[model samples]
Target: MARSLTAAIFATALGFSACLLNAAPAQAATGTITGLAGKCLDVAGANSADGTAVQLYDCNGTAAQQWSVGSDGSIRALGKCLDVTDNSTGDGAKAQLWSCTGGPNQKWSVSAAHDIVNPQANKCLDVTGNNSANTTRIQIWSCSGGANQKWNAPAGGDDGTPSGFVVTEAQFNQMFPNRNSFYSYSGLTSALSAYPGFAQTGSDTVRKQEAAAFLANVSHETGGLVYVVEQNTANYPNYCDWSQPYGCPAGQAAYYGRGPIQLSWNFNYKAAGDALGVDLLNNPWLVQNDSAIAWKTGLWYWNTQSGPGTMTPHNAMVNQAGFGQTIRSINGSLECDGRNPAQVQSRVDAYQRFTQILGVSAGGNLYC
Candidate 1:
């Protein structure tokens, strides 16, 4: 009797296991994605271009608006992957329609709160500027759990100008309204394009932080991007870096601090010019004369040089090493360790303001 009872119990357990194994998997969802003020995710003008903008528009139940969320971790519309531009994980990076290649940037996950997040950047798909108007571009930003970052995906297909920089022309003007004539926004934009990854090295938050850090340094270096060249004539001839074989072909005094970051020294000019495909070594004057070249030199320094710090300023920001490290990276020997507290405070003040303007937290470690 005992053996028979045990046998029956074993049979029942086996049947339950079989039932569990036979259960069907959940189906992938398809629907319209609605967000902020009832705007829908839209393909711009229903165009099929690879880089076509994914924007916010009025919900009209068009084929262009249809989207499906796949179990493969992709949100698809019009048979193309909703992709981050250049597979970039940086904040303010644009999102567009692209051929599905199974890239990480193409992967997205809908959260319990209905935020469509890019796992690669660990950020949310956001409507730029939170504007509900038609044709507002979509972008990736730090997941703030804000209404703009929330989305209703799998029930819909959803979705700027300012080609290079994320900040608008108006904002740029506000930042440097009375700046020097040599600081051209168009020129800076054009130059930044040459290095597609400049100031966009990591997640969206990091990108914005790095931009603020760089600009803050620039503000300190050039007095609000006003001076094209260093004002102290005494230091002009000291930047020759005589160890270089090519020497200061543009004359010893020509290598003074110039441009947004105030690039200095003969070797720096050569390195910046070579990297940008310009002849800055022989024509160091171009650093001050041409707006684009000037900006490029500044970016070259920001992206490449470590100065006194162990890592480049770009790396410092991207690695979450704090703004103080960036100051050290740029001029640690002179400014760090309470050596120049006022100068350090100035950069930190600019960073604070810029972060507020950027709609992100300033993060920790403000000083070296």
Candidate 2:
């Protein structure tokens, strides 16, 4: 009811995206479409092709299940529209849309030549598209610039930026810098250029403090993004049980790591996925690969979690140490101790590099 209208509104808004596409168009259309050769669900099951109503299905890898993305931000399989299932455009529908008229929900972006960004949600569209033969589906996700979202377009997608290309690393660095709290360098510049809401108000000292804290945690957790896997774990299960409260169980199975902190558990995945429009149960890697999802999770943790005093400073300061604490709280368990003494010490080296980059004293107190 309300959800359907929301999707309609989203679709209508997309009709006007072309107007806003001027600021950063090339970044929006950088990917290519691989036919939906391996995009179908085998468990619940649905097969969508041109002109046919696309339906939901478990990963089965059938001939009728192939899908392809287009340079124009359109999704087509068997020559049909990859639409929202039931034509319902609710805020939290699983990635189970069917073939229908090319609406905004069906429109997507290939901003990175490897990633497909969905402008409507300001995130990337993923294959849920694991390399597996079955259990693959397409869904909108945050932009991680991971391979899943990236597509190698032969003719390339749109290039709407005033510069005739998407944002460059220099431009991105200028706009986001090491201090910008939330800025991704994709074609999102157009959408974000006017988002005065993204302005930072902290003093130079506070900015340094915040950036140092953010960098420390980011360095410790991701080894500065080096520890990240080449491909995002897109096919992991959502792991929800109907009887369980909020569909997340209360045990080890429920709490597996995800994203930088690798916030685990079916509950967290469900919550995050619901907000982001992907079915967490169907595709769990949204935590890692989706840039927007990762950012959302990071922000959620920084603002809402508390943890042990030893691993991170989640409870110490709301600014930076607290953010670090959220990481430790989420990923610093003995069970998931992938970081060794040497690796831990490496964070210090990384923090030094961070300070040099930002020209600030990265408080050595939390350094590995």
Candidate 3:
């Protein structure tokens, strides 16, 4: 009898360990990206072909402007990223998106030089004579190797590269504000208080690891610093309506999927609310400010309760490993397909960039 009881206890412990291991990895809280905001972009079109209008929007979970920062330090978006626009060496030439031909234009080298010059264009991504002011639009100009052309990615800014780009803190904040903190979702305390599960994770190595994983996942989902100023209602109808008590109204059933994880659909909102103890039907902004709750909403689909054996956050990532696709599903995307090799590789590269910072290696494979 004693031996049988001991075996049962060991089996229960093993089951508990397995359950904990299956939980999503928490992401670290990355600080604001210092000076590479303008370099990032969104797809903003149905077909991600050549000449798609790659616009500069704040990364707020939209599929249009999501990007991948390559280890070689190239910025990729919309299948293709910002290249030197055919490697021109003339002034007034507009920077356009092109196929990842791996030419000199696409092959950017972020060196101790800090000069992001395109030999194809003979121009550098300059800062208007190096003036770090508000709303300072970056321009491509002659590559004289001046300080203005020289960029530095600061020690904290994890752009994968060791050196490149620098901007004022205020300007950087404008480019990348704390998502939930910026929208003001009745203070961080409310969101934290609403979800005790996250708090129970504890503030040790486990919590930090989880935070890093969560932040990295969401940042990838929301397009990093590029999505700092997106319209909350752009994806969902009642997404921004605070006046609604138990959802938008009789006719407004489409107002779901908001915040970093794009918490959408009434079913999803109520489900997340049930888990986090917040009325997500009424307060959708909780997905941003409250890190714990935000993660809860993002992870709600992971459990079998929502939809068993179907495409969910955990299963999709474990299999597909594309951040863009995960967000596209939650927000109802028409153009952004995360299953593409280019898209998946781009995000995988970004994940590698962060892991490099954290000093971990998947041994060439991102999926560990």
Candidate 4:
């Protein structure tokens, strides 16, 4: 919940992370990568020969499909690495078996959205032409966040609600029964692609706690999600800071609070928009008008900004530093340290209720 103080300033623009994966554990896991049409990613004909094609096949209990996602970012099987043929980064560059060379071409990242990406190519491991045949080849293609690009790789957290989101639509409605139609479940889930690590790190309890903490703050900020834009119009004109090189381009009063986090300030609009490729500085009203964009702004702040605290809110919950740290990160200057105990309690109560809904303990350090 970005408040009016300079403390509310959300910082930096992350266009796309170098790797969308959470940091791999000391020993990355070895398993079969299930892909399109429920097939296993396989080495063609179970052959170990160099340059053998990597394709999709029925899930047989065979060593040909057995593979490992290494901590160093290599996918290995059949004593060879999954390689982009000839080290090409171009789209449609086919994947094949090659001896492990520790080259950039073989580097890949599996993200929270179930997409396996080749970072060097900035592309997803795609089924050629979206085919479901047994021998359909694998290739690198521009990431579209499509099902064709998704993979059920090792190391996924089972934190999602029944709808494959951290929070179910039913739970969301229960949390914000009076929430405006502007905040849609689909919109929020769609925005998760921008920051793959949110609610995806650490143990299952930690994941649920992180989700609860973020939404608790959002629930308080929006008054149980009833407000789409800031209710206090008096602060509309006050949010525009004149010192930035790109002065308030959306007019002085346009940068007021909006979205789940009620993101405000000219610099914050620029930062969130730039990070999301949305041009929010000029079209600041989009946060209130577009549900997905509105949700994206909130995620952008949660995942990237430290605000008045030492770490981002995402880090606070994942590191098990308690929900109090999230409150400090968001509005400590005005609300924490007994300056405004009532407001902090409002946030904590929501955290407790939300965690109960999630079937998890609220954990320690309930207040700042």
Name the top TM-score candidate. 4
Candidate 3 per-residue lDDT over residues 1-368, each given as its tens digit: 01100000011101001112112212211221234443323344434677554333344455444444443334455456556555665663445566655444553333344554543343566655455544344456766556556554323212222222221233223433654354232222233222222211322222222223334544544565234223344444433344535545323544344444455555456656776567776655555455556545544543222131134433333333443433333322311344334434544555555444444442222331
Best by lDDT: 4
TM-score of each: 0.60, 0.37, 0.35, 0.68
**Decreasing TM-score order of the candidates:** 4, 1, 2, 3
lDDT of 4 by residue, 240-339 (tens): 8899899998999999888888898898999889989899999999999999899899888887887888888887886678899888888888788899
lDDT of 3 at 189: 24
Per-residue error for 214 in candidate 3, Å, reads 2.8
Q: How accurate is candidate 4 locally (lDDT)?
A: 0.78
lDDT by candidate, in order shown: 0.72, 0.40, 0.40, 0.78
Candidate 1's TM-score reads 0.60
Supply the TM-score for candidate 4: 0.68
Model 3, runs deviating above 4 Å = 1-212, 225-235, 238-256, 285-296, 299-338, 363-368
Q: Write the per-residue lDDT of candidate 1 for residues 123-230, one digit (tens) a residue.
A: 789999989899999999987778988887763211122342445566667767678877877877777644444444443466668778887887777777777777
